[model samples]
Every structure is written in C-alpha cells, then in structure tokens.
Target: MPLILFNKPFQVLCQFSPQEGRQSLADYLSIPGIYPAGRLDADSEGLMLLTDDGALQHKIAHPDHKEAKTYLVQVDGIPDAASLARLQAPIDLGDFVTKPCRAVRIAEPEWLWPRNPPIRTRADKPTGWIAITLEEGKNRQVRRMTAAVGLPTLRLVRSSIGPFSLATHPLMPGEFVEIPVAALKSKR
Candidate 1:
C-alpha cells in the first residue's frame, strides 16, 4: 500500500478523474488507486493526502473522527474581537449549524505562495489572516463561516489534517512525495 502527500494547487479538483477542462489531480498525479483521503475545494489549495488503503482514508476524512482540519484563510476585512467571537460560535447555516470551531487571527503566512491570479487588492479595505480548524468537512463550510461573521474569505488554503502538514511534508504545487502506508496508519 502506498500513501502519498500532495501539495494541491489552486483550481485543481480533489479527484483523480477528469472533469471537463478544469484541472484535476490527474494533471499532477499519475499513480493508480491512490485516492484523496479528504477533499479540498477547487478554489482552495494546500495539503491533500492520497492513499490506497480504505481504512486509513476513512479515518482521515470521516467527520465523526473529528480530525482537526486546519485552514489558513485570507479574509476581506480585519475581523474585530466580536466578529472573531462569532466565528468561534456555532452559527446556524440554515440547513445545519456549524460545530464550534477555533478561529484565531494570524499573520499572513510568510511561506505562502502568491496565487496564479492574485486576489483582488483594495487599498481602502484592509485584509487579514485567520487560522480556522474544523472537524467536519462540509461543503464550503470555511468560506460560509467567515462570511456569516462578515469576513468574506478571499483565499483559503488547508494547511493540515491531524498530524500531517504541508510544511513538514514539503511538496510544492503539482508535486508529491510517497510515504509508506503503514507509516501513515501509525500516525493518528
């Protein structure tokens, strides 16, 4: 069994299968039977783990497992303390209420690469960064949560899932490194 760590670039789909003309993992990864353990939105970027083992994949991606999935989010406005509090609170999203998540203001990551098409800059409206960690992988949850708190996310990048990290693994966009499946299974 093989476990692979990939630095998924922005605009890439999480699946290996092709989706029309949009970029997919197949554009970067060629190995067979190594499906993504979890999903990252097409507009988002960062660490995405792939594995051949079903059990290991479930452990990392399952919502009930409550694995900490951390995102480095760039938002439009600097959220005040009250807005930050609202983010940590379990706000209702009409259909479902989000689980209480940890959201803390963080400096823009110095290690981050500029997006291919840079985020729109507004000299008048300042932007800031926040680290938001969630246990559930709901569709567009991070972006919705920030928006609910009046901080619209301009760019989002998932930095880690559980103990695995893009920094520790060290792969650039479109690059990946293989790890032993047994090693990944032992990690959590």
Candidate 2:
C-alpha cells in the first residue's frame, strides 16, 4: 500500500473532493485510492499523511493509538511560564477536557515557509511561537487550549505526526513523498 506524506498549504482543504472555491488534496495529489489519515483545518498549514492501508490509517488518525501530533503555533501573546504550564495541564473546553501534552516556547522555525496571507500581528502587542504536541485532536483543540490559557493562536501548523516530520521530509507546500507502510509502523 502506498503511504504519502504531503506538506499541506494554507487555505487548502484536507479532503479530496472539489468545492466551489476551496482547494483540496486533489489539486496536489492525483494518485487514486490514498486517503488522508487525519485532518488539518484549511487555515492550518503543514504535514499530512495519506495512505491506502485502512488499518494504518486508523492507527494514525484514531486518538486511541495516542500517536503524538506536533504543531508550531503562533499566539497573540508572549506566553509566560505559567501559561506554558497551563498548556501541559488538563484543561476544560466546555465539551471536553484536554489530555496532558508537551507545550514549550520555540524560536520561529527558520525553515518554515511564509503563508500566502500572512498572520496579522499588532504593533503594540507581541506574538511568539510555541511547539505543542498532543496525542488527542479535538475540534480546534490547539486554538481553544491556547485561548483558554490566555494565548490566542494566530497561526497553527502541524509540523509532525508520530515518526513523520515535515522537517525530515522538507517538502514545500503541496509537495509530497511516497513511503512504505512498514517504514512508518516500524517507527512506532
């Protein structure tokens, strides 16, 4: 089975279907039968894995597997130690409480490409980057968690999933690489 690692671009939909104006995986990938393992919102940009193997897809996407998904987030405020700790602590988002995860401040990744429509920043207020790795992905979990911790997210990017990293692959937005299913599962 073919396992594809794609660097999804900003404003691109995670699905393969065509929409009236939104761009989808079909625009970057034409290889039939491969489906996205999980979702990254259209506003978010970075690594996304696609595969034809159903079991592998389930392992990668399902929260039950507890496969870590790492993100590079730009938040509205300069997150302090207290705020960063709050990110790693269990927090409520009304519908559900988030699982404990890694959250740390990081220098802006120099290798990261610029988004098409750049993130808005305030002249008076400062913005900073934080790397957050979560095993469970709720609907807009990163955004919600950051906001709850008093650090509103401005831009969010999934830089890695399990053993697959956008850094190691180094694919530009819309670029992809094919890999063996065994290679990925073995990394687990």
Candidate 3:
C-alpha cells in the first residue's frame, strides 16, 4: 500500500472528481491509482493524504479511528479563552453534537505563506489565529465551530495529520508526491 502526503492549497478540491466550474485534484495529482484518504473543502487548504490501500485510507479517514488532524485557522475576531472553551467543549450542530476538540490562540507565524487569492482584510477590523486539533472529521467543522463561538473563520489550513506534516512536505498549490509502500508500512 502506498500513502502520500500533500499540501493542499486554498480553492483546490481534494478529490479528482470533476466539477462544473471548479478546480479539483485532477488538475494537480497525476499519479495513477492514487486517491485521497480524506477530503478538504476547496475553500480550505492544508495537509491532505492520498493512498492506494483501502484499509489505510479507512484508518485515516474514519472518524472512529480518531487520527488527529491539526489546523491553523485565521478568524474574523480575537478569540478569548471563554470563547475557546466553548470550542473545546462539544458543539451541537442540530444534526449531532461534535466530538471534543482542542483549540488555542497562536501567534502569527513569521513563515506563513500568503494565499493566492488572499483572505479578505478590513481596515477597521482586527483578526487573530487559532490552532485547533480534532479527532473527528466533519463538514466545515472548524469554520462552523469558530462561527458558533462568535469568531468566524476567515481562512483555514490543515497543518498536520497524524505523523505526516505539510511543513516537511512543503508542497505549493497543485503539487503532490507519492510515498512508496515500504515507507507507508514502516510508519507504523
């Protein structure tokens, strides 16, 4: 089984599926027989995994497997501890309550890369960053979580998943690398 680490960029779809007027993984990844282990929304950017092994894919994608996925989020407002506490606690999204999540304010990284279509900035508004890690994957969870806490997410990026990291891989938008079966197996 082969597993690859990818640094998915903003507005890049995670899957190879075709969209009417949107970009997808097909535009970037050309490795035959490879598929994303999980998905990141086109509006979100960060670490994405691709693999040829069904079991390994399932392990990484299934919420029950509880593989931690960490994200660096720039939000519309400064998040106070009380607000962050609300995030760490479970959130009821009507359909279901989200699993416990970890969130904390973080200083802006000096090395953070700029987005191609940069996040909107307002002259009269101030914003901050938060680092959140969750075991369960959900639709726009971080964005939704922040919104629920009164701080809407302006930009979202996945920095790491399990032991794989975007910092080490350092792929620009529309780039990918294939990890050999031996390395994938050795990771365990």
Candidate 4:
C-alpha cells in the first residue's frame, strides 16, 4: 500500500471529485484508488495524507484514534494570553465543543510558502501566528475556535498529522511524495 503526503494549495477542494470552478485533489493527483484520509478545507492549505489502505485511512481520520494534527494559523490580531489560553482549553462552538489542545504563539514559519492569492491585510491591525494541535478535527474547527477568541483566521495551514510533518518532508504546493507505511511509527 502506498501512503502519499501531498502539499495541498489554498482554495483547492479536499475531494478528488470535480467541483466546477475549483481545483481538487484530482487536479494534482492521478493515482488510482488513493483517497484522502482526512480533509482540509478549501480555504486552508498544506499537508494532506492520502492512502489506498482502508484501515490506515480509518486510523488517521477517525476521532477515536486520537491522532494529533497541527496547524500554523494566522489570525487578524495578536492573541493575548487569555485568548491563547482559551484556544488551549476546550470551547463550545455550538455544533460541538472542541477538546483541550495545545496552542501557543509562534513566529511565522520561515518554511511557509506564500498563498497564490495572498490573504487580505490591514495596515493598522497587526496579525499573529499560532501553532495549534488537536486530536479531533471537525468542520472549520480551528477557524471557529480562533473566531471565538475574537481573532478571525486570515490563513490556515496544516503542518502535520500524526507522525508526518511538512518540516521533515518538505514539498511545494501541488507536490506529493510516497513513503512506506512503516514510517508512521516514527516519532511525531
């Protein structure tokens, strides 16, 4: 079985299926039978895992497995200590309350690739970055969580999932690499 790590670009739909005016995984990947183990929103960018094995997909995507996913998030304003604390703790997002996760302010990653269509900026209001880790991913959960703290997300990027990371396996947008399934046992 092949496990693929793809650097999904911003505004590309997560699905392999066509979506009219938008790009999808199919636009970048043509491998037969491989499907995304988990989803990253179209507005977001970065690492995505695709595999042909059903069990491996389940383990990576299912909330019960508790695989950690980390994101480098850019928000509209600098987060105060209180806001960072709120992000680390669980918060009710109406649809569901997120689990307590790690959240900390981080310098903008030097390895990050710029989005094709850059995020809108405000000269007067400064933006900040945070590295947030979560075990369970829900629909737009990170964006919603940041919004709850009054810092709307400007750009979101998934840097890692479980034992794989973009830092270790760097790729430009729309590029992908194949790795042995055994690599999943390596340290996160």
TM-score of each: 0.96, 0.97, 0.94, 0.97
What C-alpha lDDT, on a 0 to 100 scale, does residue 66 get in candidate 2? 89
Q: Per-residue lDDT tens digits of candidate 2, residues 54-79?
A: 99899899999988999999999898
Any residue pairs clashing in model 1, and if so which?
Answer: none
The RMSD of every model to the true structure, in order and in angstroms, is 1.2, 1.0, 1.4, 1.3
- lDDT of candidates 1 onward, in order: 0.89, 0.93, 0.85, 0.94
RMSD of candidate 2 to the true fold?
A: 1.0
Task: Give me the runs in candidate 4 sitting further than 4 Å from their true place.
Answer: 185-188
- Candidate 4 has an lDDT of 0.94
lDDT of each residue in 22-141, candidate 3, tens digit only:
878888778788788889998998789998778888999999888899999999989898999999999997777998889999987665789989888898889999999999988888
lDDT of 4 by residue, 1-188 (tens): 89999999999999988989999999999999999999999999999999999998999899999999999999999988999999999899998899999999999999899888988887999999999999999999999999999999999999999988999999999999999757655543
- Look at candidate 3 and give me any clashing residue pairs: none
Candidate 2 has a TM-score of 0.97
lDDT digits (tens) for residues 1-188 of candidate 1: 78888989999989877889899999998898889988989999999888888987898889989899999999999978898899898989888999888999999998888888899998999999999998887999999999998999999999898888887887678889898756766885
Worst ten in a row by lDDT for model 1: 179-188
Best-to-worst TM-score order: 2, 4, 1, 3
Off by over 4 Å in 1: none
Report the C-alpha displacement of residue 98, candidate 2, in angstroms: 0.3
